[model samples]
Target: MSADFAGETARLYARFRRDLPSDQAAELAAQLGLTADDLLLDLGCGTGQLTAPLLPHCAGAVAVDPEPGMLTGLRDRGLPGVVAVLGADTDLPQLGRVLPPLGALVVGNALHWTDEASALAAGAALLRPGGGLAVVTQGPPLWLGGAPWQQAVRAVLEQFLGPVTATCGSDAAALADRVGLLEAQGLTVRVSSWRADHPVDAAWVLGHLGSALPGDALTSGGLRQALEDELDRQTGPLVEQVLTTAVVARRT
Candidate 1:
């Protein structure tokens, strides 16, 4: 739910797209019963990373990113049947124009950036009855364990950038909040948490952090290399983190 971590985040994700786990996407799609008839909306869609992969699975999908650069990146990728819209999370005017009543609306890690009440209200209004909403997010496990490398990266990243914590993460509380929010709007909530063992060390942490860093932070490869080298020196590959969570709800 970070509004500030757009540019560098997009750049880093653009790089990560090469390593995307399509298996994970397929799993989530199966869990949600995503269909070609289902209209999916990717809210806070960063560079259409999720949006593009979703095209082959869903009937049609629309990706909305407020950042133009991110939208351009998504467009350059040329995802067929997926339309990219440039708009805000709370107000998706272009979505209204491009999509019919959505069968599924996805807010990937970006819902945390919106006003909770407002977003919930909008979801209630936008989705068709029986439609589903999925909130997906990822973060390092160090945040939970207070591990040295995790602590180290957070200290520096927070120092350099603002606290771009994954607020609506794979936590029980955050997932519960999504369920509660949906139920409050008279929707059926189905919540599930799945964790993936990602190889982590200082190098991996730096790559992940680099994804969250500001745009200017990545302009110089030397600076990126220096940071990565620092991370490598501090921590070895022993830090394997569990990448988790996909909270899905349905509008009844």
Candidate 2:
């Protein structure tokens, strides 16, 4: 299934989607043996959240996404040493022709949207000798976890978005499965986790929900009002614990 974001949805995503912390990005870079001479490829780079921060550590980067609006957001940032490419995981081979052999290919929270095996193979093909591929998957959204206000938020989400999956990407089994797939593609895989806390207010919560749900769902279904009312009942700021797991695989 092709996942493409456009229009206001892309705008919300660019505004609300969080980037990986700098410390975590540096740690992953070190693990991948990325250096200033290396070229990084950020596959499915939504608004350059995970791609922009890592630019300083690499020679240059190619940020690829199928959505033009997301690319426009990235381009608007005017980040140097980065080129935005309009393509998906399947187009990496063609992308390689225009760009140098990559030192690392990074996929953040986007592996589920593509053919995982084919994407990995294409990534491996694009990498230079001794280059690597890294896949970073974040844990569940804060609203889905066991916080008092978060519980209320989730109830509103379920009422409109249907039953939420407990474990979408960040789980032990899923990590292991990704490792196995990478290994099968002739890569030596390693996994690591990072934990951080993010403080968010009511506005952040609502914006996050808006990014996930369609505008019609939020505006027409009375879901937006219900969420606002529930959030208003909360007393303090919400602390969201972010757990990011990285599966790094090196082509031998």
Q: Name the best candidate (by lDDT).
A: 2
- Give a tens-digit lDDT track for model 2, residues 79-150: 998989999998988887877888999998888888888998889888888888999977666666677888
Deviation from native of the Cα of residue 51 in model 2, angstroms = 0.7
RMSD of each: 3.8, 1.9
Per-residue lDDT, model 1, residue 156, is 56
Which number leads on TM-score?
2
- List the global CA lDDT of all models: 0.65, 0.84
Candidate 1's clash total is: 2
Please give each candidate's TM-score.
0.79, 0.94
lDDT of 1 by residue, 127-223 (tens): 7776777777664334434556666656555554556465445567777787788778887667665555565655455555566545556445465
